[model samples]
Target: MSYTVNCSILLTDLPLLERPAAAKAAGFDAVEFWWPFAGSVPGDRDVDAFVGALRDAGVQLTGLNFNAGNMPGGDRGLVSWPARSQEFLDNLDVVAAIGERTGCRAFNALYGNRQDGCTPEEQDELGVQNLVRAGRAVQRIGGTVLLEPVSGADAYPLKTARDALGVIAQVRQNGADNIRLLADFYHLAVNGDDVAAVIENHTAEFGHIQIADAPGRNEPGTGELPLQQWISRSRQLGYSGHVGLEYRASQEDPFAWIAAWAHV
Candidate 1:
């Protein structure tokens, strides 16, 4: 698997419009990002500007997230909240249009942390309904909808690859087979899963793969996880998707980490 820069975590020192060019300068022709701009749905001008930036930078958008709700404000995601289902659904069209513009074929929809006064059953029901719709939308665009296991610290329900896979299965049962897993190694490692084994055993089931070192969600080689071993093992297992660089850039030039992966 090759690498794709996650601009949301990287190039923070630069403006959003400049990050894709920065990634391109760093030798990455592909990039992915969480929701850009201040809200779930930005204006058409903002969306056009974003797509234009990617095009002007000559970078491919391999993946994108549906509105997860004010990420910096602790809104882990809103896709599963019953009351926010409409907002989530509305955000789908926005992301789908962006995907069409960028030729991106993967969309990740985060299942938010549990909310006050809402039952798990209600959240799950709403989540299924929304994901089914999302799955169908992306399917029309020749894309795959993704579900990822976020950290427990965020109080999010899905905390492991298996957790996301279970939901993927449920989403499939609800009549959307386009749903797949977004396997983030750092979260799985933090949650105490055998990350390497997961890759070796379930690589075929993953739609996207992201990585950061364990103990600290920093760049590869900055923490305890044998990122190279697992990454290399992933390629050996025939997992052909890009291994997204979703880790935080260190104090030093973050682009340097890209070279260190060369020996892997």
Candidate 2:
């Protein structure tokens, strides 16, 4: 069982180049980012430079999270609004192209908020339709889009693994093969579900996994959830992919938590 650190944890004050190097120095071979390509990180840091830093540090680019599009007065996502479908597709194409260039094969497609205007059934259908289009685009770029079911407290629609699985099934039923699922431990624990069971049952549809303990959303050891047990169970379920450490550190230094994982 390999592990990858989510660069967002160490990206606070350091430059983009230093983040991956810090992760590698902390003993991670791969790293993930929430939205590093958004070009909002001050200075002229671009995707190519970020990728070059990863290569120089001998770290693999694991995953790139797509924009959720839930701004103040903007279109949340393609699920509830049909007019933004083209915009969603175009954004996906741009993101996928960047992922291909960075050697990242997994991308997280955030299903945006569920407004009062759309019915539950309507939202489900539209979400599937948009995913089908996005999935096709991802397939063209040799990558997979994992649907992350944000917790209800965190987002509007798709609050559980069950909800995400339904969306993935709908996409498969529509003959789309590029869409998959992401099982995040923090979200699962917050939603009160068995993370290991969900991963075991949905292994085929699951492409990536992120973890943090529940309640505080901090590193695994800081919360009440049993991280080692989940990792052991994941191995039993035949998950060969890297489990991403997407948690915040309670203390200032991130390497402290990394050193604590040495026993596991």
Taken over the whole model, the C-alpha lDDT of each candidate is: 0.86, 0.73
lDDT tens digits, residue span 1-264, model 1: 278999998899899999999999988889999989676678989998999999999999999999888787788777888777788888888888888888999998999888889898888888888889999888878989989988745578888888788888888999999988888989899988889789988888889889998777987878888888887787788877898999887757775666656643
The 10 consecutive residues of candidate 2 with the worst lDDT sum are: 36-45
Candidate 2 lDDT by residue in tens digits, 1-264: 288888866555787678899888777789987666442232334666877888888888889766545443443344435545555665776677767777888988777676566676776778888788777877877888888866644435677889888888889899788877898878877887777688678766668878887778887778788777776677677767888888777777655665656443
In model 2, state the lDDT of residue 246.
81
Residue clash pairs of candidate 1: none
lDDT of 2: 0.73
Worst 10 residues of 1 by lDDT: 255-264
What TM-score would each prediction reach against the true structure? 0.96, 0.85
Which parts of model 2 have CA positions greater than 4 angstroms off?
Answer: 39-45, 70-84, 152-155, 258-264
Residue 59's C-alpha lDDT in candidate 2? 88
C-alpha lDDT (0 to 100) for residue 232 of candidate 1:
78
RMSD of each: 1.4, 3.4
